[model samples]
Target: MRATMMDELHKPYVDTARSKGLPTYKVILKYPVRHAVTPLASTIGWQLPNLVSGSAIVAIVLSLPTTGPYLLQALQGQYMYLAGTFLMMLAVLTIIGTLLSDIILALLDPRIRLS
Candidate 1:
C-alpha cells in the first residue's frame, strides 16, 4: 500500500504512468497535490543517520565499556583511556548530532519528505 502511494506521488512513476495516461508533474502540481511528510520520516527514522536511527545499536555498543579503547574512554570517569574516550565521544556525538538536524529539517519543511 505504501509503495503504491509513493508510486503515485512521483512524476512519470518509472515511465509506466505515462503509458497509462496518468498525470505527470505538470498536471499534478497544477492540481495541488499534497501529502503529509512527518509519518514517513517517522517510519524512516530507524535506519536514518540520526539518534532515532540505530540508537539501539549505539546503546548496545556503549553498554559494554571495556570493549574498545575508544568505547572504553567514552563511558565516564578518569580511566586511563580518558583522552581516547573524549575523542571517541566527540566523533560519536557528531554522528549523533544528525538527529537534531533531521528534526530541524523536518520542522522547517513539512514537505521535506515526499509522500
Candidate 2:
C-alpha cells in the first residue's frame, strides 16, 4: 500500500523524532484528519466521514433555533443543483486536503523531503 511505502521511507525521521521524544505519528497521521489546533492530526482526521458527521450533528443542534429548517427546505427544493455542488465541492476538498496532508507529512519527516 502507498501508506506503507511512505511510512517505510519515513522510518528514519520517525525514529529520529521518537528518539527526541516527539509523537512521531504526527508525520503519518495527517493524511486522514485536519484540525487547525494540531494542524497535522487535525488535517488528517478531517478527511474521515465521521468528523463530518459529527460536525453535521453539531450544526443541526445549533441550527435548531433559526437556520436549519430553512436551509433543509432550500436544499430539498434545489435537489439537483445541491447534489451537483456537493459532489464538486467534495471532490475539490478531498484533493486539496490530501495535498495539504502530504505537504505536512513531508515537512515533518526529513527522509521524505530528500525524495
Candidate 3:
C-alpha cells in the first residue's frame, strides 16, 4: 500500500506542486497522500468484514464464546435461520461500510462522485 501510494505521489501533479513553491511536506501531504487516502479508505472499509470473520477463527482456536464460531457452527449444522441471520448481519455491515467509504471518498476527491 505504501509503495502504491508512493507511486501515486511521484506523478506529475506532485511535481506541479513542487514547481509551484509548495514545501516538501505540504506538497506530499496535499497532493499525493491526499489522493492515496481514497483507496486506502475504501480498502479499510471492505476489510471490516474480514476482520469480523477472521476473529471467528481466532475465537475457535482460543475457545472463546463469540458469534463467529457459533455462526460457523450454525452453518455446519444446516441451521438455516441462524446462518441467514449471521449472513445478513455481515452483509449489512459490509454494505454500510462501503457506502460510508464511498461518501467520504467522493467528498475528498472531486473526480469521483456517488450518484
On TM-score, the candidate that comes out on top is 3
Q: For candidate 2, write residues 1-115 as lDDT tens digits.
A: 4555454544565566556765646744543222222344336834743333234445676864333344455477887766565556556767767777677766655445653
Candidate number of the best lDDT: 3
Q: lDDT tens digits, residues 7-39, model 1?
A: 545645335545666656754433223333334
> What are the runs in model 2 whose C-alpha is more than 4 Å off?
1-42, 45-54, 64-75
lDDT measured at residue 112 in model 1 versus the true structure, 0 to 100: 67
* Per-residue lDDT of model 3, residues 1-115, tens digit only: 5876879877988888899998999987777776878778777778877766668878988988778898989989999999999889889889988988888888778888744
Candidate 1 lDDT trough over 10 residues, lowest sum: 29-38
TM-score of decoy 2 = 0.43
lDDT of 2: 0.52
TM-scores vs. true structure, each candidate: 0.28, 0.43, 0.81
Mind sharing the TM-score for model 1? Answer: 0.28
Q: What are the Cα lDDT values of the candidates?
A: 0.48, 0.52, 0.82
Q: Runs in model 3 with CA error above 4 Å?
A: none
What are the runs in model 1 whose C-alpha is more than 4 Å off?
Answer: 1-80
lDDT of model 2, residue 38 = 34
